[model samples]
Target: MKALISTGGQGPDFEKVKDIFTHVNLVVAADSGLNRLVEWGIEPDFLVGDGDSIDTENVATKKYSYNPAPRDKDFSDTELAIIKCLEKGADEIILIGGGEGRLDHTLSNVGMVKKYAQISLWMTSKEIITILSPGNFITHHLPQTQLSIFPLDDHSGPVKTRGLVWELEHIDLNQSMSLSNRCVDSEINWEITQGRFLLLATYE
Candidate 1:
């Protein structure tokens, strides 16, 4: 089954989550995100986090809770939610409502990508997807949208990109060599030959 994971930040676009839930079998809320889910009148199946951000009593009466300690040995709230969903047999995760708050939390949410190699989708209404890995990936884009690719690891190898306005031919992308190219058509493709890369595809 697929799972939709929400973070403990400002809520995501209702339409975005609505579109995703149609394909997923489960919904998970990370901390205060449970309140956002309730505010939107959407029911989540699981709640995983430290419980400091939301009322455990509310979660208990409405959904299954997996509360961890504030000083837990591992995993952020988003990470915990993703882990819980995976434990429940979810093969895919759709993460939303993750980037609208603090910079540290936003960075932490992105860091969660390095931990999971499975198929995952992240959206914030404004940004359609921001993915990571060392494999070929293709996504549709509206004309004029921008797609940026940067090596996630230090001194990564060459990354080949196709179907973009400024295509790269096995060009090395690093902290300084990240590529931000505009989409030329409805489709864009990329292949990472070396280290992990973050593909931030978005439209303004």
Candidate 2:
């Protein structure tokens, strides 16, 4: 199943986000994310959070399955929402409203993508962020879109790419050697022999 988890970060453009809702199998809210949905006049299928940031009076009128976690739990509300998606057999998880928040929370959400790299995980705002594991992957983007790649592991070995302003071939990418490149073609291909990397594509 494809699941979309909305977090309590910066609010998203409802017009743009509405399109994504049509494509996903399920929609989940993480605490104040319910507030965002409420603003958009949409109710999520599952609400997973501590209920601390949500407006109780407003949420009480909404009809949805609520899974409340302890406020003092180890996992954040967003993380708990992700677990709920997994429990519901989600193979592809997309996170919305994940950027432009507390720096720590934003960073934690990015880290979550790495932790769940075995599955197809992504986070988006004005840009889409994905962690590419060791494999061959292809991406399609408009020409001149900002595409940046960073090594998630200590070293990404034998990485190869095509259709970018700055292409690579069997290059060892480390933390200090991030690629702030741009897409040059409608289709871009990438392959990594070892280690994981993060790809960020900014929307124009």
Candidate 3:
């Protein structure tokens, strides 16, 4: 199943979330994320959080099911939402509102994608970010969108790409290298020979 997870950080544009809402099998909210959905006049299938950042009365009016967690816990509210999605057999998860907030929280949320590497996961704000495991991956984006690739660990070996302004042919990537490149074509094809990396695409 495909899951859409809204987190309690800086939310993405309403249009962006709405565009994919119809494609998801499930929608979940984490804490203040409920507030975001309420503002958008949309209700999620399930809500997961500690009930700390949301108005209890407002939530009571919503008919959606909720899973309250302890205020003090090992995981963040977003993580809890992810766990719920996974428990419900979600093979793919799209995380919204996970970026552009508390630096630590944003980092933690990004780390979650790495932890759940077995599943296809994405985090989006002004930019869409995903971890690319070793294999061929294809993506489509508008022309002129900025595309960047970075090694998640010490180094990634022999990365190859096409459809970008600066195409790569089996080139090594490391933390120090930031390919602030752009897509000349709508279709992007990439392959990683070894190791994993983060792929980011955003409007310039």
Candidate 4:
């Protein structure tokens, strides 16, 4: 199953986010992230978080599975939300979050995607971050978007890319450092034979 988790950060333009709704089987709101959904008039299937960032008085009134954790818990609201998604048998997760707010949260959210292969994509307010795990991915998002593809982990080697100005091929070393590459075609493809890497596509 595919799950969509929303975090309390800057939100993407609703018009640009319409396509993702058609692909998700589950929708989740992480703590105050519900506020963003409320703004968009989108209700989530599950609301998981510490219930501290938003108005707690109205939480119970919402018709959804509200799993509230202690505010002093070890996990973050976003992490808790992902755990909830995994418990529901979600094989793929698309995290909807913004790049604004706490910087640690932003980095940690991106780290979760890099650490866990189940997270295929993270659609932020500013960019579309794709985590590739040694396979092929084709995205038809934002033609000519400022794209930067690189291997976050050095072990990620032997990667191939198509439809980018600077395609990764016939390169030496264990990791790649290709940046400032734009989508040559409306549909862009990326493939890696081994290890993992991440691709950042700006919403420009």
Candidate 5:
């Protein structure tokens, strides 16, 4: 199933979430993420967090499953939510509403690419990041949207891209990045020969 994992923090507008809401099979909230979902009139299927930023009384009226952890746990709320999503047999996971306030937190959130292959996309209010495996990939966007794509690890294989202002063909992704390219076609495409790379598209 496609699980939509919402983590605490700001910058995940309703439009971004709504764009894929119909494709999502489940919604799991982490910590204050419940409040974000509630603001959008969305009731998540499960809630997991350290109970630091959430309101217990508000959750008591809900019927979804709740898994609370101690404030001193090793895992972050987003990690806990991911584990819960895995437990629910989610084959595909999309993370949204992650915090970019703290540099460390944002780094950890983006670094999740090294750990979870099930997570394919991250949609925030300002940016959209996608993980492309060894295959063909394509997505639509507004005209002239800026994009940057590269491998998190410096070991990705050759990649080819199309529909950008500056196109690429079979270039080593680790050695070169297609940075600051605008999607003039209102669509982007990529073909990966092997390994994984991240494609980041900024809305603002």
Candidate 6:
């Protein structure tokens, strides 16, 4: 089943998000993300975090509360939520509000998304972010929207992107480069040979 995790991030269309994610089988709140559920009058099935940023008692029950350590340096709240979902046999993950007002948190959340690379992870806000390995990827976009594929690590060889405005062929994309790519078509597809890449599909 698919899992939905809410994070305390800056999302302008928060009110409109619930409708987009109503198909999710289970809902989870990460730390202060519980406030987002409260704003919508919807209680999450589980709450995962350090329990410092949020009060566990405010939720429907403390039974599903997963309190880690305030000093634990292994995982972030978002990463913990992903592990919980994975343990419960989740095949896909959808994250909302992961790009909140804080730049550090937003960047950390993106890193967390990459850590859950074993599963099909998708982050949604005003835009959608996804990661793909060496495989055929397909996604739809609106007119003038941008789509960029950048290698997360140093490229071992070459990569190719098709159906985009500024297509790349066997290009070396490392962490030092590749960000804010613009989309040029209503549909996009790509193929890769070296390293895993992050796909940022935006509607701007």
C-alpha lDDT of candidate 3 relative to the true structure: 0.79
lDDT of 1 at 43: 82
lDDT of 6 by residue, 65-134 (tens): 5555475758888888888888888888877776537788877876776667644545555566666777
Better of 3 and 6 by TM-score: 3
Mind giving the per-residue lDDT tens digits that candidate 1 earns over 113-204?
A: 66675546777645666565667887677887888776666666777777788887745466455446888887877677677766777646
Clashes of 2: 0
Q: Give per-residue CA lDDT, model 3, range 22-51, as digits (tens).
A: 899988898888888888888899999999
Clashes of 3: 0
lDDT of 3 at 77: 91
Please say which candidate is ahead in lDDT: 4 or 5: 5
Candidate 4 local lDDT, 101-140, one digit each (tens): 8888877886787666789888888888877677777777
RMSD in Å for model 2: 2.1
Candidate 4 to native Cα RMSD, angstroms: 2.4
Best by lDDT, which number? 5
Taking the candidates one at a time, how many backbone clashes does each contain? 0, 0, 0, 0, 0, 5
Candidate 5, residue 170: Cα displacement in angstroms equals: 7.5
Model 1, position 189, has a per-residue lDDT of 77
The reply for model 1, stretches above 4 Å from the true place, is 55-63, 66-73, 135-137, 177-180
Model 5 misses residue 137 by how many Å?
3.6
Q: Which sequence of candidate numbers ranks them by lDDT, best first?
A: 5, 4, 3, 2, 1, 6
What overall lDDT goes with each candidate model?
A: 0.73, 0.79, 0.79, 0.80, 0.82, 0.69
lDDT of 5 at 110: 74
C-alpha lDDT of candidate 4 relative to the true structure:
0.80
